[model samples]
Target: MYLSYEETKDIAYYMCDRTQRLTLPMLVNLLLDVSEKQSDSLERGEAYIRDRGLNWIILHYAFDIGRMPRLNERVYIETFATEYNKLFTYRTFIVRDSNRTELIKVETTFALLDSKKRKMARIPEDIVAPYKAEYSKRIRRNKKPDEVNSEEYNEKQYAVRYFDIDGNNHVNNSHYINWILDSLDSTFLLDHDITRGVITFNKEVSENQLVFSQSSIREEEGLNSDHIIKTEDTVHCSATFTWDKVKRRNMNGYDQ
Candidate 1:
């Protein structure tokens, strides 16, 4: 079922901070919450699918954070079932302000797993049917970076300090944003406001892993510029972060 108006606003608030602009990781977390809530509401007791035994392990996730319009402006975020193949289920999100128009769009694919066995598991039929019913369109899967070619960007590398790893013993998904932002010079970050972003996680970086972060930019005549990140010896992930020349509010300490 589509999320309610009240639910959408609550999610937006959960994702944004004092500045009222949503961050990339916050947007991803909210989408996960929406999907879990929807699954729990299904007729059958299939909500356990939301829990991957311990915590939900992301197979693949990506999102776009649009520029904030104004203070105290109400924004809405909604997630809907997109499609499900044999082992993976796809979900999508759209964010907008009070008028119910879309500001940003996000898509992700997840696989059910037996975490202990580290093996793929079948998604319950009841849970799968609801998503299939909600979204009948074909699922368009995102491409994974080729393992061999992804390593060409290793010239830029950073040591993953102790604090960077989360309770899960892996780099926190949010920290990837911090690393990405850090890769840019202070002048560039200060000069631009992130208007939109698209990121795909190819592999998990473990604790104490000395990973490399690399980025490239291309400026078009009138289109927004593009940026990407890759690990040394492999392109662990790639993203296109677009920025608005006009600054809205100072982000200050809002990296998550």
Candidate 2:
């Protein structure tokens, strides 16, 4: 089901810091929260599948940061299931602010997991039924394949720190975004605000693994530019992020 007007406002409000500009990590966390809530709602009145843990294993995620808006501005947003393949489920997001038409668009893939073994498992019938009912038209059957274009982007280096790994014992998906964002020059970051991003993870970076972060920029037709990231020998991930030279809201109080 789509979020109600008040529900959407509440989510949009929480998406930003006190200054009201949302960060990449904040948007990622918000997506996770909403997915978990939907999962819980589907599993209600049924025996919790202890083997299939509630947390989703993020295979890949992409965000299109559309525009930057001021704090206290009314923004409307919604997220819905888009597809379910043999092993992964896809979801999409759209956001818009008061003065503009569209602010952001995002799509992500997730897998139901056996948390302890770190393996894929089937989603329980009851749990999957509600989502299918609500989003059958949006669900596509195509499965995502693992592939990367290693020759296109230039490679850079990164030293993976201890904090990069999450409870699942591998590099957290959000950390990939951090590495990509860090690869951009500090001056660029300070001068412009990120308006959109599209990222896909090809492989996981484990603890202490020296990672090669690669990127390339292209002048696109729109107001934003295109970007990609890869490892030295392997293309770990690729993404496109757009930026606008606008007054950015201070988000120092927000969690990174």
- Model 1 lDDT tens row, 165-245: 755455666667666656666566656677655666666676666766665444543223333445556655655566655
What lDDT tens digits, residue by residue, belong to model 2 across residues 1-256? 5432212443456555344566576666655555555656666321354434644567666666665444556655556675565566777767777654877777777666666666677655555556663433343432332222345554557788888776556676766776676666655565667765666666666667787665544455433433444445666666666667646434553223
RMSD of each: 5.5, 5.9
**Decoy 2 TM-score against native:** 0.66
Choose the strongest candidate by lDDT.
2
**Against the unseen true structure, what C-alpha lDDT does each candidate score?**
0.57, 0.59
Show pairs that collide, candidate 2: 63-197, 65-195, 65-196
Model 1, total clashes? 5
